[model samples]
Target: MNVYISADMEGISGVVHGAQTEPGAREYDRACALMLGEVNAAVEGALAAGAARVVVNDSHWNMRNLRIEELHPAAELISGSPKPFSMVQGLDASFDAALFVGYHAMSGTSPASIDHTYTDAIHHVWLNGREVGEIGINAAFAGFHGVPVALVTGDQMATAEARALLGEVATVQVKEAYSRSAARCLPVAEARRLVREGARAALAQRRGPLRFDAPYALKVEFVNTGQAEMAALMPGSERLDHRVVQYSHTSYVEVYRAWRVFYNLAGAA
Candidate 1:
C-alpha cells in the first residue's frame, strides 16, 4: 500500500516557540531535527506495516523545513512553496492512507501550542458553519482524492481536534500545550516510540476516505477586515461581514481551489 505523510513543525516534540519554527532562528535547526525524527518514525512504522510506497510532504511555513539528507531512505520528500494545494499538495487517489505528523490546532484554540489553521493570515475556517482546523481541511482534501486519513501525530490538542473531526484515527501526542508558546513535552525518545507504534496501527485501519458533501460552503475569517474585503473580490466569494468571506462550490475540489484563493488573498494581511 502507498502511504502519504504530511509533516508540519509547530507540533513536533519540544516545539513551543515561534522562533523554533522560523527558518533562520537559532532554535529552528533543532526544531527541524525533531521534526525529522518524528517523520522518520512514521516512515519506519508505515514500512514495517507493509506499505509498498511512502511519500513525505513538508507542510510547514515555507514547505521546505525537512532536512533532505536526514529523511528516511524509504520515502520521497516533497518540499518548497507556492504549490497550488499547499499542505495537501501531493495528495491524489493513488495513495491508500494519509498520515499527518507535527500538525497543530486551529487559530485561537485554547492552550494549543502555536496553533493556526493553514496560514498566519486567518483566525479560523468554517465548513458548513462547522469550525474546522488545518487537520480537518487537509483530511477533507485527501478524502476528495479517495485517501483516508488514518493517523495524526502532534500535541494533545491536535489529537483532540483530530478525534473530534475525523473520528478515532490513531494518534500520538508529542506534547501537551499549556499555552500558545508553552507545552509539557514528552522526551524525544518516548514521543518517537508512540509515533511509530501509532503509525503502524493507524495504517492497518480499514477506514474509508472522509468526504464532505458536495455543494460545499466555506467561510474564512481573516485576521482583519482588509484581508476579508480583499478575499471578497474573488469571483463567487461574498463578504459575510468585516472579517469573513463566504464561498460556495458544487464540488469539494472547487471549494478547495477557492480556499486557496481566499487564503492567498488573506495572507496579504
Candidate 2:
C-alpha cells in the first residue's frame, strides 16, 4: 500500500505559541525539530506496516518547514508554497491512505492549541451546512480522490476534531491544551512513539474515506467585512452578509480550490 502524510506545525509536540511556528522566531528551530521527529516516526511506522511508498507534504504556513535532508530516506517529500491542492497537494487517487500530523482545531475553538482554519482571516468554514476545520476540509479532499484519512496526530482538541469528523480513525494526542497558546505537552520521545503506533494501527485498519455528496455548497465566514468583500470578488462566490461568502459546485475539488482562492483574497484585505 501507498501512504500520504500531510504535516502541519501548530500542534507539533513542543509548539505552544505562534512564535514557534513562525520562520524567524527563536523557538522555530526547536519546533521544526519536534515536528520532524513525529513525521519520521509516522514514516517509519507506515513502512513497517508494508507500505511500498510514502509521500510527505509540508502542509503549514510557507509550506517549507520540513527539511528534506532531515527526513527519513525512504519517503519522498513535497515542500513549497502555492501548490495546486495546498495542504493535500501531491495527493491523488493513486494513494491507499492519508495521514494528518500535527493538526489543530478550528478557529474560535477554545483550549485548542493555536487554533485557526487555513488562515487567520477565515473565522469559520462550512461544507454543505456542517462547520469544519482543516482536518475536515483536507480529509474531504482526500475522499474526493478515493483515499481514506487513517491517522491524525496532534493535541487533544485536534484528535477529538478528527474523530468527530472522520469516525473511528486512529489518533495520537501529543498534548492537552489549556488555551489557544498553552498546552501540557508530552515528551518528544513519547509523542513520537504514540504517533508511530497510531500510524501503524491506522494503516492496518484501512478505514473508508469520508466523502460528501455532490452539489457541494461552501460557506466561509471571514473575520471582517473587508475580508468578506475580497473573497466575494471570486467568480461564483456570493456575499451572504457582511462577513460571509458562499460558493457552490457539483465537484468538491472545485469547491476546495475556490476555498483557497477565498482565503488568499481575504488575506489581501
Candidate 3:
C-alpha cells in the first residue's frame, strides 16, 4: 500500500500555546521535535503494516518544520511553504490511503488549540453548503485522487469533526482542547502509541479507493469583505453575502483550483 501522511504541528502532543507553533520561538523547537516524533511513529506503523511506500508531507504553517535527515529512512518527505496545494501538496490519484497527523479544528472551534483553516484571514469554508475545515478540504483532495483517508490524529475536536465529515475513518485524539490556544495533551509516548494503533487498524479496513464528490460547490467566508470581493472575480464565483463568495465546478480539481484562488486573494490585497 502507498500511504500519504500530512502532518501539521498545532495538535501535536505538548503544543499548548501560540508561541509553541510560531516560528523563531524557543517553544517551537520543542514542538517541532514532538511533531517529528509523532510523524515517525505513523510512518513506522505504516511500514510495519506492509505499506510499500510512505510519504510524509510537512503541512504546517511554514511547511518546513520537519528535519529531513531525521525522518524515517523508509519514507519520503515533502516539506516547504507557498506550494500550490498548500497542505495537500504532492497529493494525486495514486495513493491507496492518506493520514492526517497532528491536525487542529476549524477557525472559531471552541477549546481547539491553534485552530485555523488554511489562513487566519478566512473565517470559514463550505463545500456544497456544508461547513468544513482543513480536514474536510484535504479529505476532498484525497477523495479527488481516488484515495481514502485511512486515519487522522489530532485534538479531540478535530478528530470528531473529521469523523463527521469523512464517515468511518479511524481517528486518534492526541489532546483535549481547553481553548483555541491551549489543550490538555496526552504524553508524547502515549499519543504516538495511539497513532500507531489507529493507523494499523484503519489500513486493515481500507476499502476501494475513495474520490471527492464531483461537480463540487464551494463557499468561502472571509474575515473581511475585501477578501470576498476579490474572490468573487473568479469565473463562476458569486458574491453570496458581505463576506462570502460561492463557486461551483464540474470537477474536484476545478474546485480545488478555485479554492486556491480564493485563498490567494487575501495575499494579493
Candidate 4:
C-alpha cells in the first residue's frame, strides 16, 4: 500500500508555545527535531506495515520545517510553499491512505495547544453547515481524491477532534493541554512509540475515505469584518455578513482551492 503523511508543528510533542513553531524562534529548532522524530516514526511504522511508498508533506507554516537529510531515507518529502493544495499538497487519488501528524484543534478550541485553523484570521469554517478545522478540511480534500485518513497524532484535543469527525479513526495523543499554549507533554520516546503504533494499526484497519455529498457549500468566518471584506474580493465568493464569506462548487477540490484563496486574501487584513 502507498501512504501519505502531512506533518504540522503546533501539536508536536513538547510544543506548547508560539515561539516553538516560528521559524527563527529560539525553541523552533528543538520543535523541528521533535516533529522530525514523530514523522520518522510514522514513516517507519508505515514501512513495517508493508507500505511500498510513503510520502511526507511539510504541512506546517512556511511548509519547509522538515529537513530532507534528517528524514527517513525510505520516504520522499514534499517541502516548500505556494503548493496549490497547501497542507494537503502532493496528495491525490493514487495513495491508499493519509496520516495527519502533529495537528492541533480548530480555532477557539480551548485547552488545545496553539489552536488555530489554517490561520489566526479565520474564526471558523463550515462545509455544508458543519463546522470544521484543518483536520476536517484536509480530510475532505483527501476524500475528494479517494484517500482515507487513517491516522492522526497530536495533543488530547486534536485527537478528540479527529475522532469526532472521523468516527473510530486511529489517533495518538502526545500531550494534554491546560490552555492554548500550556500542555503536559509526553516523553519524546513514548510519544514516538505511540505514533508509530497508531500508524501501524490504522493502516492495518484501513477505513474508507470521508466523502461529502456535492454540490459543496464552503463558508469561512473571519475574526473581523475587514478580513471578510478582503476574502469577499474573490470573484466567486459572497460576503454573507460582516465577517463571513461563502463559496460553492460542484467539486470538493474546487472548494478546497477556493478556501486557500479566501484565507490568502484574508491575510492582507
Candidate 5:
C-alpha cells in the first residue's frame, strides 16, 4: 500500500497555546520534537503493516514544521510550502490510503486547542452548503484523487469531527481541550503508542474515497468586509454578502483550487 500523510501541528500532544505551535515560543522546540515522535510512530506503524511506500507532508503553518533530518528512514517527506494543494499538496490518485495527523477543529469550535481552519482572517468554509474545516477540505481533496481518509488523530473535537465527516474509521485522541489554548494531554509516550496503533488499524480496513458530489459549491466567509471584497475579485466567485463569497465548479479539483484562492486573497487583503 502507498500511503499519504498530511501532518499538522496544533493538535499534537502537549500543544495547546500559540506559543507551542508557532516559532519564537520557549516550548516550540519541545513541541516540534513531540510532533516528530508522533508522526514517526505513524510512519513506522504504516510500514509495519506492509505498506510499500509512505509519503509524509509537513502540512502545518508555513508548511515546514517536521524535522526532516530526524524523520523515519523508511518514509519520504514533503516539506515547505506555496504548493498548489496546500495541506494536501502531495496527494494524488496513486495512494491507497490517507491519514491526517495532529489536525484541529474549525474556527469557533468550543474547547478545541489552537483551533482555526486556515488563518484567523477567514471565519469559516462551506462546501455544498456543509460547513467544513481543514480536515474536511483536505479529505475532499484526497477523495478527489480516489483516496480514502483512513485515520485522523488530534484533540477531542478534532477526532469527533473527523468521525462525523468521514464516517467511522480509526482515531487517536491525544488530548481533551479545556479551552482553546489549554488541554488535558496524554503523555508523549502514550500519545505515540496510540497513534502507532491507530494508523495500523486504520490501514487494515478496506480503503475507499470519501465521495463529494460533483458540481461543488465552495463558499468562504471572511472576518472583515474588505477580505470578502478582495476574494470576490476572483473570476468565478460571486459575492453573496459583505463577508461571504461563493464559487461554483463541476470539478472537485477546480472547487478546491478556487477555495485556495479565496482564502489566500482574503488573508492577504
Candidate 6:
C-alpha cells in the first residue's frame, strides 16, 4: 500500500510559541527534529505494516522545514509552498490512505497552541455552514481525491477536533494544550509509541479512501470587514455580511482552487 503524510509543525510536541515554529531559532531547530522524528515513526510503522511506499509532505510555514538529509531513507519528502494544492500537494486517489501529522485546532479554538485555520488573519472557515479547522479543509481536499485520513496526530485539542470531523479514523494526542502558546506534552518515547501504534491499527481496517461529497459551498469569514470586502470582489462571490463571503462550485477541487484565490485576494489589499 502507498501512504501520504501531510505534516504540519504547530502541533508538534513541545511547540508552544511562534519562535518554536519559525525557521530561525534554537527552539525551531529542536522542534524540527521532534517533528521529523514523529514523521519517521509513522513511516516506520507503515513500512512494518507492509506499506510499499510512503511520502511526507512538509506542510508547515514555507513548507521546507524538514531536514531532508535526516529523513528516513525509505521516505520521500515534499517541501516548499505556493504550489497548486499547498499542504495536500502531490496527493491523489492513488494512495491507499493519508495521515495528518502535527496538526492543530481551528482558528479561534481555545487553548490550542497557535490555533488558526489557514491563517490567523481569518476568523472562520465553513463548508456548507459547518465550521472547520485545517483538518476539515485538508480532509475535504483529500476526500475529493478518494483518500481516507486513516491516522491523525497532534495535541489533545487537534485530535479531538479531528475525531469530531473524522469519527472513524485513528487519532493520537502527543500533547495537551493549556493555551495558544502552551501545552502539557508527552515525553518523546511515549509520543512515538502512540503514533506508531495508531498508524499500524488504522491501516489494518482501511476499507477505502475517506470520501466527502461536495459541490462545495464555502464561506470564509475574516477577522475584519476590510478583508471581507476585498474577498467579495472575486467575481460571483457574495458578501454574506460584513465579515464573510460565500461561493459555490461544482466540485471540491474547484472550491479549493477558489479558496486559494479568495484568500490571496483578501490579503492582497
Q: Which stretches in model 3 have alpha-carbon errors above 4 Å? A: 207-212
What does candidate 1 score in Cα RMSD to the true structure? 1.0
- Model 4 TM-score is 0.99
Error of 1 at 54 (Å): 0.3
The candidate 3 region of ten consecutive residues with least summed lDDT is 206-215
Which portions of model 6 show Cα errors greater than 4 Å?
Answer: 207-210
Per-residue lDDT of model 3, residues 47-123, tens digit only: 87889999999998899999999999999999887788888889887788999999889887987888888887789
lDDT of predicted model 3: 0.86
What is the C-alpha lDDT profile of model 2 across 1-269, one tens digit per residue? 99999999998888999989999889988889999999999999999899999999999889999999999999999999989899999899999999999999999898899999988998999998989999999999999899999998989998999999999999999999999889999988999999998899889997899989989899999999999999999999999999999999999989999999999999999
TM-score of every prediction relative to native: 0.97, 0.99, 0.95, 0.99, 0.98, 0.95
Better of 1 and 3 by lDDT: 1
The ten-residue window of minimal lDDT in model 1 covers 205-214
User: What's the number of clashes in each of the models?
Assistant: 0, 0, 2, 0, 0, 1
Q: Of 2 and 6, which scores higher on lDDT?
A: 2
**Error in Å for residue 75 of model 2:** 0.5
Q: State each model's CA lDDT, in order.
A: 0.89, 0.93, 0.86, 0.94, 0.90, 0.86
Residue pairs that clash (backbone atoms under 3 angstroms), model 4: none
lDDT for position 259 in model 1: 93
Q: Model 5: which ten-residue window has the lowest total lDDT?
A: 206-215
* Residues 44-86, model 6: lDDT tens digits: 8888778999999999988988988998899999988888988
